[model samples]
Target: MSDHPHPPSFDENILKKVEALQEKYAAMGQDLNAYLDGLLHADYLTYWDYINLDTLLSLQHPITPFPDESIFIIYHQITELYFKLALHELDQLNTSASKDPDLILKRVSRVNRYFEALTHSFEIMVDGMDQDQFLKFRMSLLPASGFQSAQYRMIEIRSTSFDRLLREEVREKYEDHAPGDLEELYSHIYWKAGAVELATGKKTLTLRQFEVKYDRTLLELAENTFEVNLRSLWNGLPVAAQTDDLRQALRWLDTNVNINWPLSHYKSAVRYLQRDPEDIAATGGTNWQKYLPPRFQRRIFYPELWSEQELANWGKGWVEKEVFGVK
Candidate 1:
């Protein structure tokens, strides 16, 4: 009864925030009252709903009833998700004008880590499945090869320009051409050579279908990424930001993606698909023995970052010894 004016029970900070929000909305010509009313009815965010876990789990639709088929589907889905996450970081790098060296290094390191994880976990393909089951069920997946992974291609495009991705023999020809001639440039990408049928000298249906679906999209991506590519972005950084740590990160990324990952993938193909005299043609009908080897493809993303000896021996020694048990 002897109380001076009683204080309100609610947080004063929250009340202040509401007032600030109201002022902010009003300044922007928005209806603050309506928004506040809607906020009153909103439920708290749940982890499952926020991530859409149910929908993600529902995406594993295996065409074959084979038990291991889901394993194949899920692992590829996981790889795609990882690729998407890497692309998210790349997209930020592409759009950012912050010029923060630490931030650039962090993004590059994150991408390098992603590729490293992919390179290491490729054992999931090499040894995860029963070889007989893989070879048997693969027949059901005709014209649908991992070669058609558009995100992998997008990652390559974002990493460097198209010429950097060309076969070594023709890189000079494409580099000397008009910069805007992406159509002509796209025609000569190393994969085109990979997908050409050996006897008939025609494009494989896998590559043809891939072109039909993604050629325009890839062209657009190439144009968008030409200047904003990771190499260009690194080059744009202030000279002081280009430290040894950054250079090592770039070189490691280049080697992991181009060499380690390719060698791992080629080993898996050899394990499950090779038949001695002639290896089995991949589902994409690619001459994989010729195409998959990094020594032949020489897909160096950051050529300026490597030394003459490193460039001369790209993926030659350790990969050969480790993958093939070569003396």
Candidate 2:
């Protein structure tokens, strides 16, 4: 025998076979339409080979054998999946919004639907679990608060009223212009306000009609402008006005504020807390009473976009009419 022993017989044969197959496949036309069409209509058993649905479904794990525990686990798991998808969509929207800002509204509407589903799902969870029943598993979830979710944090940051630090972080990462950026964005608003004033010819239209018409036009402009801005942002491209960036940023903030539907959650928490104080203590000592603030109010995401005095006057008139039945 030669000094160099023969390479492993099986490995040599496999390598040869793979190379031969690669050459054969390469010789075939590049179009895979026929192969993909067959894969699409394959039976369930064969579907696993193409998509691995079995492996995906097998991921649900029940930590406890208790009948109710599975329901509890599955509900949260499903919500988590929804949250994941929402985050993915938001990121895609953000990228798209950067290039074509008009799409932001549509993207945000999609996100809103997910939030609605999340809100409804929570209601179902509360309805299904009694205070005592939820308590049994609540303690097992120590240090796993939803507050810690990074994706949720991203959603919150993008959608809420601006936090200076968070805004700075965003600007740093995205190459956004800072102080001048605010002025640029406000200029757009000012220009729009002037246009509204000019269009109305300073003639006072009834508040109801004015609001309806104004909102329609504003939303239309926002939708169109947002698409253009989004396309730019998505491709890391630059636009002339930094105000466009600010408006897009504020849109995310406004949507974030709208999505927080916390009042319902607070009420549900209170109901559960009344039933299972012990479970609450065991599951990380939450004081539901403290959690619920004395007065609940919706927070504004874009305070600068509106004239507070004008809004207050409108509110006063509306309240007077409603209270006095003067309408």
Winning candidate number (TM-score): 1
For 1-327, candidate 2 gives per-residue lDDT tens digits of 789988666777887975676566567843345554676897656766667777777877766545666676677677667767766655665444344445554565666677767766676665777556666666665434442334543454344322221222242342343333443332222112211122233422222243444544433333333423332343343443434645655444343333233444544565565554454554254433432321212233444444666323322342234223467
- Local distance difference test, per candidate? 0.81, 0.46
Listed in order, each prediction's TM-score against the native is 0.90, 0.50
TM-score of 2: 0.50
Choose the strongest candidate by lDDT. Answer: 1
1-327: candidate 1 lDDT, tens digit per residue: 856788667788998998999899999999998998898999999999999989989998878767777778888888898899888887786666735667767887999888889888999988999876786677788778888899999988888878877767878777644458877788777777776666677888888998999989988898887778888777788788888888888898898889988898888888888854333543544577678888888899988899999999998986678678989
Task: Report the number of backbone clashes for model 1.
Answer: 0
After superposition, which runs of candidate 2 have C-alpha atoms over 4 Å from their true positions? 1-52, 93-99, 160-260, 276-279, 287-300, 305-327
Q: How far is candidate 2 from the true structure (C-alpha RMSD, Å)?
A: 17.4
